[model samples]
Target chain A: MREFDLLAHVYRSNVDLPADVAIPPGDDMGAIRLGGQTLLVTVDQLADGVHVDLATASLEQVARKAVTRNLSDVAAMAARPVGAVVAVSLPRDFGDTRATELFDSMRRTAAAFDCPLVGGDIAMWDHPLLISVTVFAEPGEVEPVLRSGAQPGDGIYVTGRLGGSNETLPDHYTHHLDFMPRITLARELAGDAATRPSSMIDLSDGLARDLKHLCDAGNLDADLTIADLPLSDGAHQAARRTNEPAWQHALGDGEDYELLFTAPRSPRIETADVPITRIGTMRPCAGATPAILLHLPDGATCKLADLPSLGWEHHA
Target chain B: MREFDLLAHVYRSNVDLPADVAIPPGDDMGAIRLGGQTLLVTVDQLADGVHVDLATASLEQVARKAVTRNLSDVAAMAARPVGAVVAVSLPRDFGDTRATELFDSMRRTAAAFDCPLVGGDIAMWDHPLLISVTVFAEPGEVEPVLRSGAQPGDGIYVTGRLGGSNETLPDHYTHHLDFMPRITLARELAGDAATRPSSMIDLSDGLARDLKHLCDAGNLDADLTIADLPLSDGAHQAARRTNEPAWQHALGDGEDYELLFTAPRSPRIETADVPITRIGTMRPCAGATPAILLHLPDGATCKLADLPSLGWEHHA
Candidate 1:
């Protein structure tokens, strides 16, 4: 069992808590109320060898990616980034200059997004460096766009193209360049009344897998058209060279950090600056065999239910 | 060089932050602003073997100690506790009941001090179980008590007896009793209107070492009277069995987590339930000499400056 399961078994026995906790434990982030404002708080940890190879990645890049990973969660909640606290466990070998570079990058990133690095902790450990960042955002009650909000008759839209993360893994993973532009664009669209989507989630864990989450949580099914998939040239070329299908790369690859949302059809919404493509439609659950029905470019229709979930799994 | 030193260099070179960060980059905690209120935020990480021995320490006690350590920091500032966030990195072998007990103990202690556990992160780590907690508190304007605030005429006062932590270490290290009450009492006493200590600190690094810190920071010297020292029976017994003086235990034993403050003599302040002992008075800085002067019962004065600083050092 996971540690959370153990925690639930031990502490969750007594369920008495104040009404301020809107979204309690066991979610991507916890939500609470403060003076009519809904606050979203989430934390993410990046270990040296497990999350990044520090020998290859610059401290600046490591710092930016650390904050961006949490920012992606803020985007998931459709919340404006407010502030963050970073706690770091450092190996004794790391010098002062490298540590400073990491903090500088974090401060710049937080400031660039108008979020402040409020507070944190620093300690020495024998283990590889662990950087954990907790981000807090003030998301006023405009209805938190959750995974369970997808509905039948809703059109699926994905912001930005996919599969490029692998071909340009260094740029996507190290520099954190790919996520910034996409997140900025997504946030702009989310803020605009004309382009606001009903339900939105950042596609960090690939299109096919994350779609299954949205569909499963909403108790609906998705019919995705493979022909309408938006694939990056780099991703397509890399997949071709590797003898892997470009569609599979676009469908199953993770860390894209792109927004995937479903909203009712609206013509006034412009997709000029934002490179969003219409991919599919939500439908009532059909058969027990397939919760997500994929309409291939070929005549074949594949069932996504029996497929294994993609992306990173902690235990696996 | 340490990772924190490197972090300081990077952050210093990269960007210009807001003006309110009084004690930024290095120190026990980072201080920031919240709508004109000075908020002190600090995080401390306790790993299984590094900070506590999980083999002997109960998970509940480990969790409580982890939070109490940070609470001691809030007490150091003479600030009231506001809230906290706890992030836990669990080894895969950790059971569910342990996680529950950990969270339950943490939540109870947080509530006991009126500082609720707002949110946190839980992840799986391969080696040791790491628990990091970040605490927040509002700084008092008149006396956001710091180590540097002591004056030459200031009299040093310590709340409660010292050296009892070693005797209670069995119960505390085993998770049989709560340490939050002692911490709360210290914080409450530090902020008491009647006392209004000029400079204050929490005694984690033993009385002699911590007094040296206060004296060094304030550019003054301190003389402690051995006769005025408060000794618990358990500490006295332990010292006697070890063939050592009981006063040494009261003076130099660490992990006391008591409040050590310096204030001018005040008629309004009288004795209360918590034991308050006038141990010493600050004097002019002796050039190239002792920062803390200990007056023993033998009538000979010994300099604490020559002694090695006590308590847990990350590198040591």
Candidate 2:
């Protein structure tokens, strides 16, 4: 079983939650009540071989990815970054130079996102570099958005173009390692009283998988029009290089770090700071066959299961 | 270089701290100002080979150690536990049964300690089990005790006996994995206006190393009497079996998870809920030899540097 599958099999929220736990596992970020205020917290990690190739990727990039990935979760919840604690298990041979580079990058990245490096633990072990970043943040002015809040008939929108984030690093492609979290956009949307997203999640494991998660959490279904998929220029270029369909990269290629949110109504297009697009609509679960329906650019319809899922696949 | 050496080389708190970060690293638990109140946070990890022998220890012990270790940090700060999140990196072959047992144990341990499990992330990698627990807590009614508050004339006291925590597990010999944190004792000491500790730290890396840490943080020295040490029966037994002195085991063995603190004056510890012992006294850094001095029963004294520095040695 893959990581997500393992989690699905084991984790169950609301079973016997303690009084302080406002939210539990299976969300973009968990919320715990603190002095009448809600704090959103999340922990994510980037392993050496599993998440990045240490040989090719700079220590800075690796550290940045570790911080940003958690920030992306914070963004999904539309929370304001407060502080972070990192835990690092390093290879035995890792010395001062590499450690300095990693911490510097981690400190710099956390600062850039307004999340300072408050505390951390580091230990040397006979294993690949494993960095676990725990981010603590204040909920949005109103409440932290959750993946399970999606309602039927909600408009599904995505910030920025998706797919092709898995491009080999140090190249010209949109490296997910350097991709920024859409925190500002999330805050603006979450703060707006009139039109905030009903539910939100960051696209880390690709559109096809993430969208399914949103639907499953809400016990809903989704219908996406292929023609409306926002294809990144990198996805297009890679499609040409690999002789693959652009749609495949746009839908399945993970590491987008983009926000895939659902709102009661289509959010008004305003600032150009970050590109936003409406790609689909949520529907009530009506069939046992598939929770997602795909509309082809050619006006043909098929279930999402018919498509070849790519990107970061958490196998079961 | 070891982990502590690397931390000493790299970590410099207050270098560029965010406005809200009240206490930084090197403390029992870092404090951040949340609203008008202070929130204490800390993260600690237990790796397979480094912290446990998975071959001998049950999954429950492994998970319990992960939670208790962080809880011990919280107890050291005398902070009220609010919640916790765990992140686990497991070997690829780790299956559903082991994962279930681990999470169940984690949930149970956290709940029992009143530090409920709010959230966590789990992943599979080509490595042994590594669990990181991040605990969030509320500062005690008073300011959280700090390691740097010790004074030269402070009385050094420790809760419970020390050493023999490293006895191979599965056999009952003061299992560090199941050791209870001294949260109530710390709260009592910290909340008491008459006899609060000047500085406090948990004995995780043995009394010798941890006492030296308390002295170094407070810019003082310590004089520990070997005769006054409270050696656990298990430690005495292990020492006899290994042909080692009980004092060595009590002073050098780590993972005791006992409270080692210093009070400005000898406090009247009335309640016998937990054993309390006075083993040493803080002193000025008058000698150039060592920050710690061991006073033998025969009236002879020696620097801590002359002793075997056993316990947990972190590699850099």
Candidate 3:
């Protein structure tokens, strides 16, 4: 709700947009069709204390997180990363050596994803470090996915395990900082028009929150099966430490960076590593209150809207 | 030297670059040749207290400056602005009203340049306001000029007046916050191969510094006649207040946002408004000690390296 509201308010414009804009400002990546080619671009910013704690994160980790997160947005749109440009405003006291380290790390990570670091801007300022990476991508052979295509009877699926990405302590190594973006799996899922996802989203913010976004965009409702949701080992460990259910950690704690999507029928792809699991089904909109139902393995139903920190205030 | 040195160090990488990259990192913008079309991308950042004094300038002025500065880079390469994505990290105390105002201003400015604000990322942090704007552009009819293309015997020229853009007091109004980028003028100058500049650069860092960039990139030296350099009215005012020569201000005080370039022969285009003046001549590099010769109106010559702030240490 917060992201949607902010986006609507900030992107409200009076200018007439060009016809080449295939996708507008509020999507995961904006697409422009020019010269028989489609270019997809998305930007993500990582700030100290907000996205990463400099006390625990090395400049390399911070740089990696910044590049990977933007790549994740590209994956959500089922696009191939082409290039990236970064802009950094670093505290004046954050020495030149660390600055070089950060840029080198970003270049290395971007190359690992086949998205080379093309160019960037760096400035020394009296502020905590903030790095904004903008990635330019090209759409797949098939039309890229959007969040507004899910329909009733569509089966919902997610790639890999989720949760405790944030609750995983820095000392224990957090997936929130180092998890791989799902670009490869996205291509595998959306490679063919016949088997492509109806709608897709990356789990940057928790499953309940991101799934809620897809449902809101499509004006649909969803019923998720708690028994089918894959939980990470970090989620189990976190639940034990907090005296909460592991499933709760899997659904609430964010930054898994996995792919969540929907299709008419789940495609059992021959992927080697990442497991594709069907965990829910899209349903017709519940009209005025469009609810997200969470069916527990113990046969109890709870509203995802009722969960605490399902990412913003429910119904606000 | 500072910008170039930082660029070299920050852009050093160990990955194999794709051959499609026409212009690599360290230039004003990186160009990618994809699908028979060229895409030019450049990024810039504006920070609080560093680029603008919030005490004197409104958020609208800051946003305008941010968008126009990057547009200036596109102008330097004779590229047409197409789209832009901005990322902002605002302080926690900066209320929602201010955030909306800032975004709206950015959108408006971007639209004025025909570069629509296509997407962005926003965050709240405990830092001075920092905005990163990345622009996507396409080349003009001819090849976009590069700084390294300046050739010996080319005539040096500039679009519009320069200097005192920084010294102009905020109350009296400074051109630094409101200057129009030279995108249109660049098109007029580089519209044809016969008349186009051999090399080009935007004077964001003053004539002495930015012109030095063109010369350094091309392995050339230059000689400027003092009376031929067009001085802004603000430059004269600053010189009167500081007791320095007005030409000193024209040669040193930065942020003019004007275009300085070189061609084999000056193209006296039939254009109105912004005046184009031939101010100097490029020469073969001096090798061991390349010098920028300044011919004063008093029939005396001085090395540009001897000026107080020719940007960075003279011989360091």
Candidate 4:
């Protein structure tokens, strides 16, 4: 339905945002200053049938996905976790057992991330369970990273492999349900002044779309090497089943829940817990060229939108 | 329905809340201290056919209710707002024009309250629009007032009048649609050292139900004087239209966005913007008695649950 893109357009076009917004809507989180500090906040929603298949996944699985996806945004901002509140609209027929499981899982997963489930509102719907979780964070001892902070010639990098999440690898306890957020790595990088990212964004809406956000917000163009794209094993599985390239899955499958950021140099991988891949580099925007260009293995260059068969909402 | 009460039960019974939760779930807003300040957060949801009838209400009206109702929770905490984020799920047939109007209204309403709309998520549902709004606040120069802070023998006071909000006064732009949050009054009281409330809560789920929340959370009982209740003009109008008593309307018709609080003494009324009324006094809980007792003009005493024809969900 293009809801996400349309909402982004509305936020960018709407001119009446209050002067106090420290970090605006283009990034992984929005921030405001108060109590002599910066409070970074973001919210994400998971709807039955849209984000998860209720018949397949348990409430515990769904709860982790909802909480972790939001924590991924906090990772993008490189902010410390304050806490979170979850609001749920359950089916009227949703019995107490399922409700208890849902809240229990939500509380445990949030506590695991050190963002306790602080407060929430509950409502009953006739059908379709909806969970909206908001996380509040503070920029701890460092400036929060912004998507607009990218500079020309910065190295574009990402944590972990991407693709086949919420898709080919979808299962009760697989990729989509259990991928860890990049918060620990982000905090490590952001805590040290010299190693902080220039710009960062969480790859939720596929590498093609989310990378374009960084480029658009920073007024820069990215040249991504498709051969260097970190395709997950699930990407290869999806590619094998569909007769599509694994790289395509890496490029276009959304809900990867990985961090895509730019820094002067990639953080040292020897001390890191996850693999960091350099897939692209940024430059000043080409006059009228597309926001992203793919450098293929055979030395061919193509606009990201020129690729066909993106699953959903991938067009510019 | 009993969604609000059920949620309170879930939060209370579900143990293992992380140790850092500064102000826990029983309060109007859950709080945690970080970055040298206490961050208070709460969320509320509005759904079609539940909180609002989309056919009768504009998306703009829904947006304000979605934002201001959450702000009312912030006021209940006696906390200064930092910012807010709104997440919405639109029906597939929901046109772009209406979405634009909704965002515009949400932005304006939030900014007007000094709590800017900082970030949000968007989704599309098959039918029935849903809105979830989260607000973050900070206790400015004072400890946040908790629901469990009511001292026995304290005076229970309320700001503005109550009744006929979601029911008999269900006009397009009256009562429920347009009640200002008592954030200014809360700020005035909480900001000053001497006038802050002993305990506070927003009168949302009618006076009887909400007063019981203070009693249950504070381990006290309330003796409410019905004759002293500040019933709104709409309460009288609704009472005249139906055969119900005006005091019953004030006690049972929910969605009253007024502030209900307990203080040692009443805040000065002449300089206050809204009418402040002392309707009750708190006392120690007598072993197994009900949480609230109502005093009639003729000196007959009855439990709040003893009132017949309460319309909806008003019970211990």
Candidate 5:
């Protein structure tokens, strides 16, 4: 039998609950009320070989990655993270010192981001170790910036540069390009009541694919100009080393964690601290046709829908 | 390498975060937003062969059990459950229909209890299926009913009967007994403002060991009467069939999900719908010793602390 089948058998019992539940269990994040505010919550599990390969990274790096990945979701909704709950299924060989270091690193990162680590569950698993982080954030009055809010004439923008996370790390622990810059930028932009994006989403699955998500959500088509893409130095270097087009890597590489948003054109918005570049505009959805139109630096344009879908598929 | 070591390696990169994070990830649950009406959030994961065996159980049962086990924690704290979020990791073999069934069961169960399923993360895993449910609750006006609230002269009370779960289900469904009586009597009793228990905790780890948690927390001793213990018909029958004392199972069997609380003897509050039995009285903590006293029917009292510690131990 499947694992879910087992869970269903042992856990699917009815319950008599009180009236305070706003959003119940089984969703991405269960929301409850604190006074008059609504809190959005969600938990994600990252397992070795399942979510990432541990052999290629450091313990502290992994811990930070886990926090960033979940925090990316909080950014997507334009919510300010309040706290988090972490549950770890450790292998028997795990020791206290290593656990402490892992926790300390995560704690520092969380504190740096304003969201505190609230509580967590630790266990010994005979199989692989699993790290599940549940984040709680306050949902603002603007109703989280959803992917479906883009309109036909909305302008599409991306914060920071993208691509090349798969390459080698930086020397002497200086700066890692993979670390998300959008967390601060998105919060800064969205928190300003004057500059809210019509639709906002984190680009974890690559801009090529994520832009499609934004366009598809509103049944709209997105047109992008390759010349406007912001390419990170590391990404450009990696593309050059591999003799590949930097634009393709910027468009197709996942784990960028940048914020991809759509909003009506506004000149009053400040773009100084945040490196936001307008890459495209939204149009009516072409139904059964390409959802994203990409203009090449050489004057040719291609439809993303016409290409083989890539990046990440949960099941694939 | 250990599982957690592997996780630490994969997720420990330095990432930028906000400033308010008091604790970061790595505890049983992370805690943040203290002082201004604290919120307690926790997530528990149930895996096939790990937490439950689902080969012989129904899907609905598995889903229900998954939700309640997490809900039981809220009951333990005497906190009102507000909402929950589910992160489901399913094997590819499990089709969308099966996933839908699991979610549907969860939705219906949450709705039945008044908590609506708001959002969640659904992913595919190569290993056994895993379901992580996170529960969110708010501590009411009264200070959070913590395990440390019991006083030396407080009366220790238990809600409902214990120990028949093992006998209530078919022999093949022994694990099913762990989650019976879906609705916790503790939540109901705590909700009634007039009779709220001073210190409330759910009996997930058997009455014998759990009461010790209360003793350790309150820095006091408990003199419990086994004769005053309430036993279900299934527990009695199971004892008779096994030629053992029924009280043993009642005190030692885990997964009871009943509320164990303490209160001052005044205010004379009674809840007719929920059965509550006074099983013990608290005493000042003895020097260098934290213990529980079991009063036998013969009026002889024995220190239960001398006996082997029973109930669930995650590592074990």
Candidate 6:
């Protein structure tokens, strides 16, 4: 069975959603009322073989990736990070030298985001190295954004280039571990209530899959123009080497820790810090089968189901 | 490299503690300031083979153990439980039915503690099953009882019995996973300024090892009378079977999930809900060689270094 299927079953049947919980499972971050403030928390894991090739990747890269990936969820809700706690189980052969490096990297990366490493657990065992990071963040001046707020007329925008996260990495790295989490940009977008996003999510599981998440959450459909997809430099280079269109990689290549948000209109985004590309629009679902439609550069239209599932399948 | 040594290194050098963090790593739970409240959080994990024999243990037992272990930490701090989030990685052979049982057990246990399961992550892989639980709690009206507050003249008290956690279980089950987390009892003691505990910790790694934690955190020594140790019924039976002193098992067997605290004096403990035993007293350190000293029933005193280290050694 798929990982999401198991998680969805657990979320639907098992969890007892208390009244204090503002956001539930299946969101970027689950939030609860903490005294007078709202606290948003999320936990994510990166396994040695599943998320990265531990042989080639450094302990620092692995540590940074684990922290940054969780921070991406913090940014998705436009929440101000408080701090984080980490839990790691290292393989038997992993030495203390690498462990020291891992913790150092985690400290540095957390400090960079103004999120300190307050607590953690570490153990050595026979299993592959696994890192689980749980982050705590506070809602910004405005209410935190949810993925279920998108409307029929909202414009779909992305913060940075998509795809190529798997392409430009050096031999020692699996993906773009150095990429920023877009925390500041999301906060800026969230500061203004009129221009704030109706719904938002981080692109960790490809454009198509993540778009479907947004659509399903909002009960709407996504209509996108393939030509408008923001192709990263690494995406173009990989497309040339692999003899494929850059847009295909842009759509399917996951690990892009960029922001995909739906706004009422192009909300006066400046192209200084990060590029904001309007690639699509939200529409009312017309049929049961096709929830996501893409207009091709060759004057053709295709449903999301028709496209080859080239991105990473978590279970596959 | 022992597990404690690795953890001590991380606690000593790795974490970057900020002003907002009241309690750092190496405690039952770390505390941070959120708005006007102090939030105490902790995350702990249990692996299949390392913690339980998955071949004989049911998935429900595994799930319950993971959540209960974390709630015990909350009880140590006398914190009000807000909620908990769980992360699990399942082995390839684990079936969907078993997964359902695991989640349902986790939910029921969390709710019993008034800590609902708000979110979680589940994955399937080739490794043995691993479960990590992160719990969030807030301090009561009074400040949380810290491990560093033990005074030289304080009396050491323990709630419930200890030891023999390794015995009395069926071939498939673990030390009773149904034990309650002393949340209400700790909160009652914390609410009163006069009768509150000077320092506290939940018993997980045996009385000897965890007592060392309290001593090290407070920079003091503990003098315990062996005869006064509250031996569990399971401990008595197991000691009879193993031809060992019941007190030996009482002090060395881990996973008791009991509360051990140091108060100024025997503070009018109500022994109705749970048994309270005044085991010993805290004292000033006399020497550097032995931090924990045990007075035997025969009136002979010995240092902890002279003991055989019968407690659990985590990865060992």
Error of 2 at B225 (Å): 0.7
**Per-chain TM-score of chain B, candidate 3?**
0.93
Off by over 4 Å in 2: A5-14, A140-142, A169-174, A288-290, A308-312, B8-14, B168-171, B287-290, B308-316
Candidate 6 clashing pairs, residues 3+ apart or interchain: none
Q: What is the lDDT of residue B2 in candidate 4?
A: 60
Model 4: docking quality category: medium
Native contacts, share recovered per candidate: 0.33, 0.48, 0.56, 0.62, 0.37, 0.45
Q: Per-residue CA lDDT of candidate 6, range B38-73, in tens?
A: 888888888887776677667777788889888999
lDDT of 4: 0.82
lDDT of 2 by residue, A1-316 (tens): 5566655544563366666678756788877788877878899878998888788778888999999999999999989888888899988788878887788789888888878787778877899999999999987465788888898889899999876676653455446777889998898888886679998999988888899989988889999988899888768877977888787788887888999999987677587478888999999999873388989888999888876655446421
lDDT of 1 by residue, A24-62 (tens): 544445665543456666777777765566876767767
Error of 5 at A117 (Å): 1.7
Interface root mean square deviation per prediction: 3.6, 2.5, 3.2, 3.2, 6.7, 2.0
Candidate 2 contains a number of clashing pairs equal to: 6
**Candidate 3 — which pairs collide?**
none
Q: What RMSD does each model have against the real structure?
A: 4.5, 2.4, 2.7, 2.8, 5.7, 2.2
lDDT of 3 by residue, B186-301 (tens): 98788876679999999877788888888888888999999999989888888888888888888887788899999998688875478999999999987665569999999999
Off by over 4 Å in 4: A1-20, A167-173, A192-195, A314-316, B1-19, B167-173, B191-195, B314-316
Task: For model 2, name the residue pairs that clash.
Answer: B1-B316, B2-B314, B2-B315, B2-B316, B3-B314, B3-B315
Instruction: Please give me the total number of clashing residue pairs in predicted model 5.
Output: 64
User: What ranking of all candidate models by TM-score puts the best one first?
Assistant: 3, 6, 2, 4, 5, 1
Q: lDDT per residue, candidate 1, B121-162, as tens digits?
A: 677767688888877665644346677778887888887677
Q: Judged by lDDT against the true structure, how good is candidate 5?
A: 0.67
The candidate that achieves the highest lDDT relative to the unseen native structure:
3
Q: Where's the lowest-lDDT run of ten residues in candidate 5 chain B? A: B21-30
Candidates 1 and 3 compared by lDDT, better number: 3
- The CAPRI class of candidate 3 is medium
Residue A58, candidate 5: alpha-carbon lDDT: 76
